[model samples]
Target: MRRIWFALFGGLFGAVGVAFLGAFRADALADPTSLATFSLWLGASTLYVLGGLDASIGDFDWYQLVGLGNVCLGLQMVARAAMTLADGTGETEPLLATFGGVVGGLTLAYIGLDWFRGGRHFDLSTFEESPTADPE
Candidate 1:
């Protein structure tokens, strides 16, 4: 079930990554970076978030990883937003829409994956700590 969720959402993120990366060469997006490096950075970060979410459930919890990923992606979007637009950048509204689209998709996937995985708890604080065996 987890694998299935990963395969589904991972592909979604990957597609969004490609769209954002391709926005540079295409007219579909505004705020296209003049440098290929930025495109790659955004694409790579998107994929990172995707891959991080797709990582198999280890001893550590998955939500913590995904939550941290939300932070990382949030930071990237914020930093990129801080940059002044180059002359003749495309529509700002569309750019924002595009950004929101990707983030929203990732968030939905995150929550959906959690629901599909069976159990849920507020394990945020201790996700990093090793799990202890239940004592009777």
Candidate 2:
């Protein structure tokens, strides 16, 4: 069951990556957005594969994979922001994108680092009840 879920997740990311790559190829020099999208999706696909392996084999550190994903996502966002600014449309949306991209990227990168250091902010085990807990 877990394997199936992981396969589906990885496949989804891989498909998106392929689509973005195709889009980029169709007009390689004109669109930077597609390139960034391809990169992030590729990273996501790789992360899921590594994560699945760690789940099954018990040697790999899944948190590190997650951290890598976060960093990739952050970089992608920053790239998008730069592309948007490069357009020079003189619009407010570009400013918003820039602000959001930088802040979100930094925040996610920090969270990723915390997870890499064994932080439990999103650890599922923390939600499990203790074996000795009294039945309510």
lDDT of 2 by residue, 14-84 (tens): 88767765777667435657566566757866776665455533454765665566666666676677777
TM-score top scorer: 2
**TM-scores of the models, in the order given:** 0.37, 0.67
Determine which window of 10 residues in candidate 1 has minimal summed lDDT.
Answer: 118-127
Can you write out model 1's per-residue Cα lDDT over 26-113, one digit (the tens) per residue?
5434444434334544444544454345555454445544544444444444444444333336888857765675566466445434
Clashes of 2: 0
Best by lDDT: 2
Global CA lDDT computed for model 1: 0.48
Q: Which stretches of candidate 2 lie over 4 Å from their true place?
A: 1-10, 24-37, 55-60, 120-136
Q: 72, model 2: CA deviation in Å?
A: 1.0
Pairs in steric clash, model 1: none
Candidate 2: the clashing residue pairs are: none
